[model samples]
Target: MDSPKGPTEWAEGRHGVGPWEGPWPDDPRFDPTLLAEGDRRNVVDAYRYWSLEAIRAELDTRRHPFHVAIENFENDMNIGTVVRTANAFLAEAVHIVGRRRWNRRGAMVTDRYQHIIHHDTVGDLVAWARGRGLAVVAIDNTPGSVPLETATLPERCVLVFGQEGPGITGDTAAAASMTCSIAQFGSTRSINAGVAAGIAMHAWIRQHGDLSRAW
Candidate 1:
């Protein structure tokens, strides 16, 4: 298990990068096992051969102030996707409410590099946010909810989402500093929880993220 010997070897797999091309870069962040075993993990090019802990530490230095929270009352499969997207957007952490366990298949192992916290109830999640002085912005298409596109998301806020069918619980909605909805034109009544989370996170990014820093 050494560096890919040629260009053809580098391009031969489903995993994007092949291996170290030459002498391994001298960096503490680089994992010896990943360097020797071909570094086939699903990661961006910048993180190639980096240890999981190393990647997490680096992400922590630049993670966005916003957090993502999803209700897990139904053992929602979409929770994993939300975590994956949260990692993609470099969110500070993901809060899982109502249930401690969630399906992680959709995360594609990215959860290993993202901070995840679990709360037993909506009130617990709200308390955690309040202690940190972070606003709770719920995403739900309900009466009195503002359009996410036109609303200003708090810089330090938790973007809470609900399960697919029932939408946000009444208690959760009441606890939110504000609830915003994604605009939909089609006949479909609502979008998937995962999709809504992505939209909401990107909306926050559009307003506060450093566009020039995107890779």
Candidate 2:
């Protein structure tokens, strides 16, 4: 644990980490010692070299109330990336319905910054949504759904999504209070799941999140 003592000293290190007084890496690429030293992932400057547990602990203290849920019936690889996006937005928790394990590579180690909940099915996620007193809003373009911009998003709500090919299942769609879609002029019927998740989260932020309080 090398403490650089002052911001001036800390800023000198790579990634604004520290003067990292400990042993250095021996590799040739930007010094093998630096690479071997600690967690060098591309996180914010505040989280450089910190252990995964340490980063998670810090994030927990400031996590927001909004929750994110994604349907994982087909074991979509996008689920992990969506979770990572939720982590970036500091969503209270990510609910995974229909499956437990998701691909981790796309997450870029951001799963450590997030809390995940596993639900047996869409009904389970709906129950959890009820327990939290959150409005369950699904993201999909379908009849009777409103434009997300016009919809008044609740401060505490669950934004649920589905797989790439099928969108959301009928059961989940039935359970949701509303399903909103991104206004797209492109030829594609829908956007990528991960991109859709990000867009949905930002929409929530615009409506409920205080930009001044965000990182």
Best-fitting candidate, scored by lDDT: 1
Model 2 RMSD in Å is 8.3
Candidate 1 versus the native: TM-score? Answer: 0.92
Q: How large is the C-alpha RMSD of every model relative to the true structure? A: 4.6, 8.3
N/CA/C clash count, model 1: 0
Error of 1 at 50 (Å): 0.8
Q: For candidate 2, what is the lDDT?
A: 0.80
Per residue, candidate 2 scores C-alpha lDDT tens digits across 49-79 of: 5556667877888887889888888898898
As for candidate 2, its clashing pairs are 24-33, 25-32, 25-33, 25-34, 26-32, 26-33, 27-32
What is the lDDT, from 0 to 100, of the residue 175 in candidate 2? 89
Query: Please, what's the RMSD in Å of model 1?
Result: 4.6
Q: Which candidate achieves the best TM-score against the true structure? A: 1
CA lDDT of each prediction against the hidden true structure: 0.91, 0.80
Cα-based lDDT at residue 85, candidate 2: 87
TM-scores, one per candidate: 0.92, 0.82
